[model samples]
Each structure stands twice: as structure tokens, then as C-alpha cells.
Target: MKVLNKGLKFAPTKKIDKFGVFVDLQKFKRSLCLKKYFLKDPVTRQVLGENDGWRHTELKKKSHFYPKHLISKEITTFETMVLDEMEKIQPMRSQNLTKEEKEALKELAEDTTITIKPADKGGGIVILNREDYDEESLRILNDRDVYQRIPYNPTEEIKKKFDKYIQKGENNEFLNEKETDYLTVKYPKIPVFYHLPKVHKNLNKPPGRPIVSGIDSISSKVAEYLDHLLQPIVRKIPSYLKDTGDIIRSLNTITWEENFLLVTCDVRSLYTNIPHNRGCEAIKTMLLEDGEIKKEQIDYIVEGIALIL
Candidate 1:
């Protein structure tokens, strides 16, 4: 089975359109037939009850049965409630726009496609110069020189390393249509859509920290797998503190005095603002210095981390 689709873009909206929507029905059926199956197989029912998360609820209750009609109606009702809440919470675009302001927007949008903007009093129709915006953005980036987004083209070395571990039928267990149907019916996959992220400042009064968002261009499962491999290496680092518990242990012996200077410094946008290439180099250096982790493992892990950057 082909595991990784090379040309696959991590766009949930496009993927959903290309494939189809997800709907769960098997879980409902299982719930409905709980009593029927339990009566037939006592041992199997007992095992299931032990494994299942529910503590007090009897697995053989006919009254607890879930039917398609009832479940579907409940789901629909919940969805309606959600929609109503959303409508109540989020004000519609152009909701409070005056007649004159709307007319002005209409006149401005006559020549080109325009999205509905906020109904603020200060002119709803402000035309943007794309070229100017791009130039200014580039200038700001160049001036800061904080970090650069690297192109993630998987090199041959990296690909070979990944291919070595990811063999046929090892981790790449392709689900059959029947299995897929059952799984999808139990836990449906929801398509996640990307939206324009708001660029904002952290509330540090002296010097506000500029923060930007990154597009999640990689599959979450792939990222999680990489994270698991990297965990051991991260744990090996002695200087770095992992959690609050570690910090507490480290500071346990310290005694406060009249002349003692205590300080807490927060890193502003540490992850995203760090230089990607430099970070990869640092990881490689750390691994090489460790002398315990094999060179092959270090190279593979470094390459995987670099690929994500």
C-alpha cells in the first residue's frame, strides 16, 4: 500500500471536496445492539464492559438503545442549537452599516470583487495597493531579520532515511474498504479550513512582542510521529527544564535573602522567531556532542526536524 502521497497538500477543504464528507453510524448501531449482543455472549459482553469507559451504566439495558431515527434527530437538534448560538454571538458583516456607507461600498466594489467588511464608521471602502503592501512587508521583514521560512523539499538523504524505517506493512497498514467504513462510522474525520491569522502584539507594556502564525502545512499524524522520536533526545538535555516540576526541584535548595535578586523572564515568540537553519545546526551539534545516540539516528532525526522547518 502507498503510504505517503508525495504531492498531497495539507489543505483539508480541498481534500474533503476531492474525497467526501464523513458521517458516523456504526457507533449508533453498536449502541442499539448492545443488549442484543450482550444476552447472546456473556463473556464477550463482560470483556467489552471492562474495556469501555462507562462505569455505572449497564451494557444490557434495552432502554439505553440508540436508533438511527432518534440519533439523527438529536444530532440535527444539536446542530440547530449550535447554529443559533453562533448567529447570536457573531454579528453579521455589514450588520450595522448605514445606507450611505453601504452605497459608498457598492460604488467602490463596482469594478472588482470585494468581501463584506466591518461596519465601522471610518469609511468601510478602503482600497489596498497589493504591490505597496508587499513592499512594506518585505522591508519590515528585512529590517527585523528575525527568522526566515525555509522551503521544505525532502532531500534524497532524508527520503532514504525515512524510507528505511517506514517499510511495507510495518507502520503503513492500509485499511480495507470495510475497515475504513467501520472506522469512519465510529469516528468521522472533520475537514479543517485555514483562515487568515491575525498579527498581534503580546501585552508586554515596555516593548510589545510582535507575533505571527504559521500555516500547518504538514499532516498532524506525521508531526506526532516525528515528535515521539525526538522526545528521548529532548529528555537527554540536562540544562533545559522540561516542566514546572523540574523547575521546582531545581529551585528547592535556594534560599531567599535580603540581597538575593530573583527574576522571571518570558521568551517572546521563541519558537516561530528562531532561525530555522541555525536551529537544525544546533540540534545536530547537541546530538553529536551527546556521544550516546548513534550517528545514524542523529542524522535521521535532524533531517526530519529540518524537513518540518
Candidate 2:
């Protein structure tokens, strides 16, 4: 209300588009939304449930989020966010090594390299060779610039490799689609498919990675409905501007004659199995009854659905 009151005072004539507000998230699913916000906006005063600091540290310093709040006060804008993330990563990123770490890496990489497992995880576990460094192996190791090892017989190494192989499958591939579901891209795994190519595809492309030209995203059915809603936005844009969509508004008009809030919303746990309207209502409730949530101590995950209308 404070923010809304301030917004209205600033622009009395500005219409409020609060129709699509709120969020419905399962507890496990909150991380997904938080991951998105941390990557995109990375500024939240209200949320502090799941803190996946490792994931943030793992993310390469790229233009994923726009830094704000204190981080932004010190370093404003998204470009700053990208750079700061990158700079912080340089020291601790590769391996838990100091100046001595690189030298150890060099010494280890040269060996024929028997494998070992201090613990089973597929990355950066290398055993220094007793023989002259294998330049071939060294190249791969040096390229990554990180390795750790503890001597184990073939039994352990073989087990480690097999487990890692399976883990890699768990991390990237296999039948599970939600593995990389964090990235809103080529395969949404929503049973719908995009006709375009992948993104971060070429950092050099025009301005950089092309923005995924689509809705914030929803289920396959919701997506199909959205596509139908967007038909008018697509056809009404000036043809000349169509080629350069950067200048044209994709969804220029609304079907419901509803003025949408300038506010951007995020919902969680919205899978193909979920109903579209249910998801929408959840978002609405979340925004409308912000303080009441505190009063009632409602579960924040489903807080978005707490609305009168």
C-alpha cells in the first residue's frame, strides 16, 4: 500500500494493472522463484527462506540480474551485477587454492593421473601423477584450472567415475526435464516447443544473447492460450517495425480490456498439471493481502491465493 500510494501520488492518471498479482508456490518450489529473482533482480526484502549460496557462486559472472538495494547502491545496474559476480568468483571459484594452488595444479596435471575419490562428486578431483605430467591430461586439467585428489585403487576410482557419470546424468540429462528447468529456454519441458534456437548461444550476437520473445511462461495449455491472446499484439504492430521487434511492442493491447499493474509478478510451482486461473489467482492474492499475511501468519508459499475476490 505504501508503494502503491507513492506510485499513485507520482502519477495520478497512471492506471493500476494489478489484475495479475500474487504467487502460489510449493515449499520446494520457492527456491526456483528465488533463483529467478536472484538472477534477474537479486533484490528482495521480503524473502529469506532458501539460500542456495552455492548456486549463486557457481553462476558465471554474466548479465543475469540487475543489482539493487545495498548492492545496487554500491554498484548500480545489471552490468554492475554481472561484473561484481564475476570479480567475486575469480579468487575462490576454481579450486580452494591460494598462490600455492596453481603450482600444485601444474604438478598434478603432468602425471599420468590415476583417479581417486576423497568423496564422490564428478568435478575437479585429480590425483597428482608420480610420473612426468601427462601434457594431454594436463591440458584438460589446466583448462579447468582446478583439481583435487586422494589416491584410491581402481575400485574406488571406478566407483567414483560410475557414480559421477550417473550424477552427471542426474544433473544434466536423463528423462527428468526439470534438471535445468531454471533456465527458461529451448526446451521448457512444458510439452510445448519453441521454433527458435538456444540462448547465451552467442554472446557476440548483435547486442548479446537474444531475449526469449515469449510470455513470462506458463504451462503448455496456458502457453497455447497465451499465444492466441498475443495474436492481436503480433498483427497490430507496424510491419516495418516487425523486423526489429526491439522497437515494437509485442503485446500492445489486452484482450480483457484490463489495465495490468506495471508491477511484475512471479509465481512458483506452476507446472503443466496446475490450472492457469489458479496460478493467476495465487499471484493476485499475494500482492493484495501483503500485511494480512503477517497478521494471520499464513504459509508464505500459498500466500498468493489469500484474496477476497
Candidate 3:
């Protein structure tokens, strides 16, 4: 399912290949196929997917698929773990602590800075930061529990320089809490590349949880398509795709050993971003070095796709 734009980067879309294959990294029903292959291929030992699924295992007989990974969901649970740790601290911390432990706690406290945060039970959501905590803010924070951690307070020199970024007459603004201000919900959907065996991932342990799957070398058309579906209000989906792909490419992951096996994965939604003219162009010039689309052939490919688009 690997594909290439083939033409120069600056070339117009109408000059690329139409049927150039697209790999859907998160495709369903490919897990079993991959598992079967892994069991047979001595060089491999695992297939990846976003999560463990029965349907995936059911399809193992598909001859053309390879193992993909299934990712963990540990990231979604960090806040809960952090909160649990926070509560236990008050009792034990006030009780007896070894001299070394007390010294460590003292160092932690001295280095700690206050950060007011958003919470469900609090009054209207807001965030604040001060050089030190205030009694009013502390009482309110104590009453309403907010997510916080000891962050290094900037040195006076850094603070002075940072002042320029704020308006001269403006009240305290430009809080990084604004940047931190985000709501995250675990996606009901699974990312591709979720589960890989030790040898495949080259890791000694099942890299702990709350992680996600990732696909590589996807088409820009897919990015454009997903941009409208996923959120962040508006996201740089294309850039994210390229950046993510660049990272994976840099790692130089090898997923294939031969060509007889056809990996079947369809983009979640292939209807969008298929520019009629561009589709034709893509169907034309995209290819690998072993198989190339000549300049003259570009027109024919685009022309062929014109009807389908």
C-alpha cells in the first residue's frame, strides 16, 4: 500500500498518480491477517492495531496483510493517578518524615510555585498565577481541588524580560494556563499501529499504556480529509501528518519483506479530498523508483481519473 507523489515536490497535483496506493494505518480487520503472517514469518513476531479486537483475529486468513500495532490508553489516566498521589501526601507529609525525606520535601516546597487551575466544582472557570500563593486563592483551591504541580518560578531576570510580552496597562494576562487550557477525552476510535511484539517494537517491555497507534507515509489527501473530521476547532492536519510521517520515516521502520502480500486498508473516508482533476493527476505520475510514471503519461492518468472523479 505504499505510494509516492513521484513528480517533483513543486509539481501540480494534476501531474501525480491517481491509483497510487494509500495505506490506512488504522484499518480494521487487518489484525488477524497480520497475526497469521507473524506466526509464519520467523523474522516477525507481532502485528499492531489500535486495540485488541476479536474481528481482527477472525480475519487472519487474509494472505496479504502484515502485523501492525495496538496502542495503550494510559495517557488518559494520568490526571487520576496524580490526584490520588496528591491526597495521600497531606496526612503522611504532616506526620513523621525521615530527615532526608524532610529535606527533600523542604527542597520540593521551596522550589514549588502556586498555579490556580480550572476545575468542575469551582466557580466559573479561570486560572491565575502569582509569585506566591494567596490565602484567598489557597482557601478556594483547597475547597475546589484543581490540577496543579510544583513548577519552577522564573528567576527575577526572566520575569523582568517576560514583562514586555504583557501590555503595559493591562492587568495580569498571558497566563500559560491559557495554553494549558484544554479539555481531553479519550478517543472512542483507535489509532493504527497499536500492538507490536517486543522484537517488532525493539523494546524489552510492553511500552506502558495510554499510548496510541501511528501509521506512516499516508497521503496528503487523507490529511485534508481528516482535517474536517477531527478537531482542535481547526487543525493543521496536513502539517501534523507530514510531521508525524517525517518522524516515523526518520526511524526507518521496515514493514515489508516481499510484494505478493497485498495489504488492504481503506482510508476512513476516501470520498473527500479526491479532487476530480487532482485525482486524475495522482492516478498518473505517482510511483516508486522500480516503477515510474513518465512525464508524458501524467496527462493520460489524469484523463482516466477525470471520469471517475
Candidate 4:
């Protein structure tokens, strides 16, 4: 069975209002005749009272439902599974391998390596590779055949916009302490670091994804404000094929021609590498073209989105 939030409306409660929690419809579920509603923690085998279910803990927030204690237990279980699977698949030591076995392994191995270490706080593993991966990654980033890289500066632009907003006393509530610090103390400086890409080993061959992380200069409040401003307008645009189901459906509708060429393209570091100025400009252009939003509002949005980039 598939549960989807495809058509759900955003209605946040007063308690937790920053990034609005998803609206859980227990009232609607009460209308259904077949079920007796209750909250149960499967891991702990604990059943809660009627008033203690969704009301006490926001149902949409998974962390609220499954707290640190439960998450730690689950992480340990998953870690054990990973270690067990690795042992089962790769029982023989690399030194014990015969010449032919080593040759076979070489044929199966990809041009990548990963080392796993236990995380300091959580019972999780930190997986990363040596500097050898950097050369290959850089090549991919610069390769025109793979991706046309576009660059933009957000640090200066964001600070300028924030300063303007502060001077004007507009959207002052949206600017949090961190964003203020970034604008004032950390002017024209944005720190960026790539998260380690996950690697799923297929016997010996392993392929890794390119690493990317979002802008971390501003506060979550500022990000949420921008999201709220842009989301409704952005939602009007036609969406691309999102998943396997969409792809299959699209394929079914296609008329396969005999002589036509089929070309596939994957944008490298798509989100992170998008030209920041171009994106903000595009959003402003679209909103202006729509003519529904006022010029002042569009200006505010564009200014807010500079930080978002």
C-alpha cells in the first residue's frame, strides 16, 4: 500500500510553526467505519492511551513519534545488519587472495574506494574516500560533456539584501540571529563543504554519487520564509518525470520512431551548481510576467531569494 501527501493542504499548528508540520486527519479517519485508531510503538511494544497519540506528539514529525532512544536502537540494528552482510559477502581477507582471485576481483571492482569509521556521537558510520576521488570529481565538474557549470556569488548579494531589509525595517521578523550574524559579522563570506556521497557495493563493483550541500550561511528561519514566499507560485509550473512510475507512463505514450536519435542527459551537481543569480532572476521574471504579484512583493521575494541561493 502507498500513502501519499500529493494533495494535502498545509495547515500548521500554533505550537510548532516554523517549518509547518503536515496536517494529520484523525477527524477524517474517525469517519471511516473499519478502524479503531491507536498509537503503537512497534520497537518498544508499547501502546499508548487515547489522548496520548497524535495529540501529544505531532504525527507528521517522525522524530517526535520515534525519539532518540528508539532511533539509536534502530541505528544499532541497521549497523549490525550492514556489518553482517559485509562479512558474509567478503569473508576472505585481501592478503589471502590467489593471483586469479585477485585478477577476478580487479575486473569486478570500480575505480573508486571507500573507508567506513564509527561516528563520534551516533552509532552510525562515517563513510569517505581518499583524495584520489577528488581528481575524478573535479574532472566531472569541469567536463562540458557531463555538465555546463554555472557559477554565482551569494555571500555579497545576501549581505547587501539583508542590510537593505534591516535599514528599511521590512521583513525584520523573518531575519533570525544567525542570518543577522552572517550579514553583519561574516560579510561576503559563505562556507561550503560537500557531504560524503553514499556508496552501495555490488559484490566488488561500487559506484558513488557526486557530493553536494546547500548554502549554510543563513538561518533556517530565512530559508523557511523564502520557501513560503516561492512555493505556491513555483507549484504552478509543469513538473518533469519524478519517478519510475512517471517514466513508465511516459514511455507507454511515446511513439518510437525508427531513425530518430535518443539522447539522455544528467545535470551534474544540479541543485548546488545552479547559477545563483540566474535562478533568482528567473523567479522574479516569472512572477513579474504573471502580473498577479505586486512589484514591491516581487522585489522582496527576489531580495529574499538572493540569500536562498
lDDT of each: 0.44, 0.32, 0.32, 0.47
In order of TM-score, best first, we have 4, 1, 2, 3
Checking candidate 4 for backbone clashes, the offending pairs are none
User: Model 4 over residues 1-309: C-alpha lDDT tens digits?
Assistant: 111233533333224322221122222223221222123323343332133221011111112222323334444565556556544553333445567866754653542564433332223344445453465466556757545655876556656665676444234333333333333434333544233333233212223355434344443335554565566667666665557797789788889999978677879568767678888888889888877556765676677667444
Sorting all predicted structures by lDDT, with the top scorer first, yields 4, 1, 2, 3
Tens-digit lDDT track of model 2 for 74-155 = 2235445554555454332333356675675566556354322121122222232222223334333342323334455334
Off by over 4 Å in 3: 1-249, 252-270, 282-292
Which residue pairs in candidate 1 collide?
none
Off by over 4 Å in 1: 1-216, 219-221, 243-253, 257-259, 266-278, 288-293
The TM-score obtained by model 3 is 0.14
Candidate 2 backbone overlaps, count: 12
Better of 2 and 4 by lDDT: 4
What CA root-mean-square deviation does each model show from the true structure?
14.5, 28.8, 27.5, 16.9
TM-score of 1: 0.36
Worst 10 residues of 2 by lDDT: 1-10
lDDT value, residue 32 of candidate 3:
47
Please give the lDDT score for candidate 3.
Answer: 0.32
The best candidate in terms of lDDT: 4
Q: In model 1, what lDDT does residue 86 have?
A: 48
